[model samples]
Target: MGPTRKRDLAAAVVAAAVLGYLLVRATYRYFPPITVWTGMSLLGVAIGLAGWGFYVRARIRDAEIGVGRGRLHPLAVARSVLIAKASAWMGAVVLGWWLAVSAYVLPRRGTLRVAAADSPGAMIAGLCALALVVAALWLQHCCRSPDDAPPDADPAPG
Candidate 1:
């Protein structure tokens, strides 16, 4: 793989690690009841899905390069980046919705009095997840195939 592809793969690995750490830390810190477990589980699943998406995209890009397709157009690059972002956002929303629902239901269970008290760690974890998504997006934007030669400025030799 080229340097750009290597960088993207590295970024994906780092993002996954960060997201995992945040999820585990937040889950224990918050110590939510059974209902909140659903939200935590969703968050974990979202992180995993987003990470896999990043890996798949990176691998595809690498394969395209190996097959000699040359570099992708800027628009294609942008589209790939957008797709990764959308996937991450979808995951985040699923997790966030679960968290919201759990918060609403938890109060009725008479265990917690305020959402704010338990949300700091969860919010930090959410932010970490967002950061991971952004990292994947940035990596997609930066990748380029080595086969993409510079544009010609001179006329062709006879």
Candidate 2:
């Protein structure tokens, strides 16, 4: 599979940020409190994907070197690539989302919504989103051809 396109991720982030900003602006009438659970969910998804990517990468490496009875299925690798792509795009959107939210919440702390909003959770989610980007890249690195990888006996994805 081809590498995840930077343009697509950037576009998604921009779109999500604009939408998020507009959403928060429009919802000012209702002024709902931002839930921490959403942020925690984002963190959970990122960590889960990263963990799964590591498992796939290890299996692929073992298969490539003809170690053990682990057989690397082409479909599994394809799925991993898809997951990486999705993670990259999702991370960008979430990062931009929380950024917009933070921008809105920062100067308006006196309001009930701003005071109650979990800005710290949003920030934590943003950091997790960043982690997902690195994880996606690492997963892509793991999917490279053996020829593309180094010739070392114990090679690692760069």
The local distance difference test score of each candidate is 0.48, 0.73
Taking all chains together, the TM-score of candidate 2 against the true structure is 0.77
Write candidate 2's Cα lDDT for 1-158 as tens digits.
Answer: 56877777878778988899899777755755666665676667767777877777788778779896686687877888888887888789887888777766766766745544657656676777777777786776676666664434566546
RMSD, every candidate, angstroms? 12.0, 5.1
Candidate number achieving the greatest lDDT relative to the actual structure: 2
Off by over 4 Å in 1: 1-46, 57-82, 88-116, 135-158
Clashing pairs in 1: none
TM-score for each candidate, following the candidate numbering: 0.32, 0.77
Judge candidate 2 against the unseen true structure and give its global Cα lDDT, from 0 to 1: 0.73
The candidate 1 region of ten consecutive residues with least summed lDDT is: 1-10
Tens digits of per-residue lDDT, candidate 1, 22-141, equal 664466445553332333543454465456545545655767667544445567655556655555554444335334433443354355444444455455444554554455444544
Task: List the lowest-lDDT window of 10 residues for candidate 2.
Answer: 149-158
